[model samples]
Target: MDALANAPDILSATAENTRHREWRLPRRAVSWLQVLPLTAILVVLFALPTLLFLVVSFFDYDRTGIYPAFLLDSYREIFTSASTLRVYGSTLKFAAIVWAITLFLGFNIAYFLIFHVRNPKIRIIFFLLCAIPFFTSAIIRTMAWIPFLGRSGVFNQAVMGLGFTSQPLSFLLFSDFSVVIAYVHLYTLLMIGPIANSLSKIDRSLVEAARDAGASRWQIMAHVIIPLSKTGIALGSILVITQVMGDYFVVRQMSGGQSASIVSALSVEIQAMQYPPAAANAIVLVVIVALMVGCLLRIVDVRKELMK
Candidate 1:
C-alpha cells in the first residue's frame, strides 16, 4: 500500500514537469521570436528589392520595354567597357580617400569629445555643434560648398584679398578637390557618431592603470584605445564607404560633369529606360560594398563587440 501511494506521487510529479516544459520556450526560440520582426522588415525592405534587382538584371530591354530573358550582356558590358571601369575606379578612389580623411577626423574628434571634455554638458554642447550642419538637407549643404569653393566665392575671394594668389584658384571649384571637400563635410559626422559611441564605452581606469605602469600616451592609445575602439572605427568606415560609393548628387554637382560616380552612371542608364543594365550595375555595386563590409567585419567582430 505504501509503494502504491509513492508511485502515484512520482507519476503526478512527472506529469507536472512535462506540462512545465511544454509551456516554457527554449532560449534559442525566444531569441528568434525577438528578432522575427526585424528579420521580416529587412526581408521586405532590403532583401526583396535586392532579389528583384538580381532577377531583373538578367532580363532583356529595348527602346520599348524590358522583357523576361536570360542574358549576360549587361554584366559583360559593365566588365568590358572602359567607361564603366573608369566610373568604378573613380568611385573606389573617392571612397578610399574619403574613408581615410573621415577616419582621421572622426577618431580625433571623438577622442576629444569623449576623453578631453570632462563636463557632460560641455560634451553635449560640442556634439551638438558638430551636428549643427546636419540639420539642413544634404543637397542644401552640398550646394552651400559650391558658393564657398567657387572661383569667385568666399574662399577664393578671401585668398585673393589676402594676396595668397594673384588669381582665383580654378582648381578649387568644379574639380575632384571640390568633390572630396563636399564628401568630407557631409560624411565626417557619420564617422564621429560611431567612434564617439565606441570611445564612451571604454573604462577610464584602464587609461589611469596604463599611466601608473609608466606607459606613454601614444602607447596607451595604440594598445588600449585603438583596440577597444575597433568596432566604432569599422562601423564608421562602412558608413563612409557606402555613402561615398552610392552618392551621385555630390559628385555630379561638385565635379561639374567632369567626374561620375557608379551611381551617377547608373542614374544615366535608368533615365534612358535601360532598366536591365541599371539593375546589373546596382547588383555589382551591392556585391562590391558587401565585400568591403565583410572585410571590415573580419577584422573586427562588430556583432560580438556590440553585444558585449
Candidate 2:
C-alpha cells in the first residue's frame, strides 16, 4: 500500500523535473533573419510590381504615360473591341497547340533519357546539350533563327541545291509557323527538366514486373509508365502553357512585328505609353495562366506525387 502511494509521488516528481528542464533549456531554432533578405527581395521584385500593375490596370492612360485616377475604361476596351477578342482567341489557340506539342515531345525525350540510356555519362552529356541553349542570351538565339530562315539563308540554299524548289519559301519566315517553331526550340529544355526529374523517381522494377507478367511493351508503357508519369505531364503542361502565353520576345522576333501575340500586343501598348491598357492586358494574361495552373492542380496532386 505504501509503495503504491509513493508511486504517484515519484511520477509527479519526474514530471515536475521534466518541466523544469524544458523551461531552463535554450530553444535552438532556425533563424528567420536568414530568410528575411529573400522575403524582402520577393516583396520588392515580384509582389510590389504585381500589385502596382493590378492597380494601374484600373486607371486611364493619357499621352504622357500617366494615368487618370479611374477604373473600368481599360477593361471595357479590352472586352468590347472585336480585334482584342480575336487576339485573345488566337492566343488561346496558340497556347493549346504549344502545350500539346511540348507534352508529347518532352515525355518522349524524358522517357528515352530515363529508360533507354543506361550510360550515365552519355545521359549527362545529352541533358547538358538541352541546357546549353539557356546559357546564351535569348535575343541572340532568336536572332540566329532569322538568318537561317531568311530568303537567302542556308535552309533556302539547301532546298535549292536539292532541286526541291526553284524559289525560297516565303511561308518559312515572318509567320505563325515560325513563331511556333521558335517557341518549341526555346521551351523544349524547360519541358525536359521537369519530365526528367519525375521520370528519375520511378522504380525500374515496376516496369520489369509488368513485362514479366506477360504484358507487351505497348501495354507496359501505356498502363504502367504513363500513369506513373502523370505528374511530369502535368508539370510540363503548366510550364509550357504559362511560358507560351506570356512570351513576347520569341513571338515578336519570329513574327517580325508583322503579327501580334497577346504579349506582343501588350508590349505595343506599353511602348506607346498606354500603361492602363498594357496593365489590363497583363491582368488578362495572369488570369488565363492562373486558370491553367488551377486546372492542373485539380487534375494532379503534384506535391504528393513529388513526395513519392
Candidate 3:
C-alpha cells in the first residue's frame, strides 16, 4: 500500500529531473535552426554546381564548350604535363609569398589597433579605414592599381622625377610581382579583421601580469600573446591563402595575361571554351585549398575560437 501511494510522486520527480537536464544541456541547438536556410541555399546553389563541375572535369570539351563522354585524359594532361606543373608551382609560390606578407602586416596592424588604440570610437574609425576599400567594386580597385603602376603611372612618374632610374620600369605593370602586390592590398583587410577580433578578446591584464613578472616584451608576445592569437593567425592565413589561390580579376587586370597564375591559366582555358580543362583546374585548386585549410586547422582550435 505504501509503495503504491509513493509511485506518482517518484514518477513526477523523475520527469522533473529529466526536464531540468534538458534545459541545462544548451540553448545553442535552437540557434542552429537559423542556419538551416543557409545550409539549404548552399546545397541548392553551390553544392549542386560544384558536383556538376567535378563530373564534367573528367570529360572532353569541344570548341563550343560542349562536353562529350571521355576518360581521365584531362586530369592526366594536367598532372603529367610540365606546363601545367609550372602553373601549379607559380600559383603555389604566389599564394605562399602573399600569405606570409599579409600575415605579418595584418598581425602587426591588428595588434596595434587592439592594444594601442584605447578609445572605442577611434578604434572603430581605424577599422573602418581598413573596411571602406571593400565597399568599392573589386574590379574597380584592380583597375585603380594600373594607373598607379603603369608606364605612365604615378609610381613611374614619381620614380623618374626622383631620378631613381633612367627608364620607366616595365616590371611593375605586367608581372607576378604586381599580381602579388594587388592581392596583398585586396586581402589585407580580411587578415586584419580576424586577427583584431582575436586580439581584442584577450585579457589586457594578462600582458600586464607578464610584465609585472619581469618578462621581457618579446617573451610576453611569444608566450602569452602569440599562443592566444594562434586562432586568429590561422584564420587570417587561410583567408589570405584562399583568396590569393583562387584570385582571377586582380591577376588578369594587373598582369594582363602576361603572367600565368593558376587562376589566369584557368581563365584562358575557360575563354578558349575548354570547359573540361577549366573544371579540372578548378577542382585541383579547390583540393589544394582544402588541404591547406585542413593543415592550418590542425595547429589552431578554430572551432573553439570562432564559437567564442
Candidate 4:
C-alpha cells in the first residue's frame, strides 16, 4: 500500500526530470542554429581557400607548371633566398613604424572624442569629418598624395613660401617618409574607429570614482581607461600591421622601387608563374599574422567584449 502511494511521487519526479531535459535540448539547438550561418560562411570562404593554398604550397612546380608530387622545395627556396630576408625586413620595418604612429594618433583622438566631448551633435559631426575621407576610393586617395608631395606641389610651395626651407624637400616624395605619410592618412581611421568604440563602451562612473579618490586626469586615463581599452588597441595594432605588411602598391609607388615587401615578392612570383613558391610565401605570412593575433587575444578577452 505504501509502495503504491509513493509511485505517484516517483513518477512525478521522473516527469519533471524529463521535462527539464526536453527544455534544454531545444535551447542548445537554437544556440547552435544561430551560429550555423556564420560557421558555414567561414568554412566556405576562408577555410576552403586557406586549405587549397596550403595543399598547393607543398606541390612541386617548375616552368612547366604544377605537378602532383609533394615537395618542400618551395619553402626551402623561400627560406634560402637572399632577397627574401631583405623583403621581409623592409615589410616588418614598415609595419612596426606604421603601427606605432597609428596607435598613438588613434588612441589620443579616441580619448578626446570619448572623454572630452560632451555634446552629442558635435561629437557626431567630428566623427563624420573623420570618416569623410574614407568615402573616397583608396586608389584615388593614394594617388592624390603624389601631386601633393611632389616638387613644386601645394605643400612644398606653402612651406617654401613660409621660409621653412629654401628648396622643396626631396625626401617628401618617393621615399620611406612618403610611404609612412600615406599609410598614416589612410589607416589611422582603422585604429581610431575601433579604439573609439572601446572607449565609448567604458563606464564613465569609473572615471569619476577614480577622480574622487584623488587621481588626476592622466592617472585615471593611465589606470582605468587604458586597462579597458587594451582590446581596442590590440585590434587596431593588428589591422594596421596586417594592412602594412600586405601592401604592394603603396610601398611600390611611394618608395620608387627602393623598398620591397612580402606582397611585392609574392606578386613577382605570381607574375613569373611560380605558383608553389607564391603559395608557400602566402602561407608563411598568414602564419605570422595568425600568431600575432593569437598573442593579442591571450592578453585581452575580446570575445567577452564582442558578446557584450
Per-model TM against the reference: 0.90, 0.85, 0.86, 0.90
Kindly provide the TM-score of model 1 when superposed on the true structure, using C-alpha atoms. 0.90
- What is the C-alpha lDDT profile of model 4 across 118-197, one tens digit per residue? 99899999999999999998878888998899997889999999999998988899999999999999999999988999
Residues 1-308 of candidate 1 have per-residue lDDT tens digits of 99854754565555556665663444445456556778999999999999998999999999999999999999999999999999999999999999999999999999999999999999999999999999999999999987898989999999999999999999988899999999999999999999999999999999999999999999999999999999999999999999999998999999998889999999999999999999999999999999999999999999998999
Q: How far does residue 185 in candidate 1 sit from its true spot (Å)?
A: 0.3
Full-model lDDT for every candidate: 0.92, 0.83, 0.86, 0.87
Candidate 3 lDDT tens digits, 209-273: 99999999999999999999999999989888998888777767777876677888888888888
Ranking of models by lDDT: 1, 4, 3, 2
RMSD to truth, every model: 8.9, 9.9, 8.6, 9.1
Determine which window of 10 residues in candidate 3 has minimal summed lDDT. 24-33
For candidate 4, what is the lDDT?
0.87
In angstroms, the error of model 4 at 270 is 1.3
Q: Which portions of model 4 show Cα errors greater than 4 Å?
A: 1-21
**235-264: candidate 2 lDDT, tens digit per residue:** 888888888888877777888776677988
Candidate 4 C-alpha error for residue 94, in Å:
0.9
Estimate candidate 1's alpha-carbon lDDT, on a 0 to 1 scale. 0.92
The better-scoring model by TM-score among 2 and 4 is 4
308: Cα error in model 1, Å: 1.3
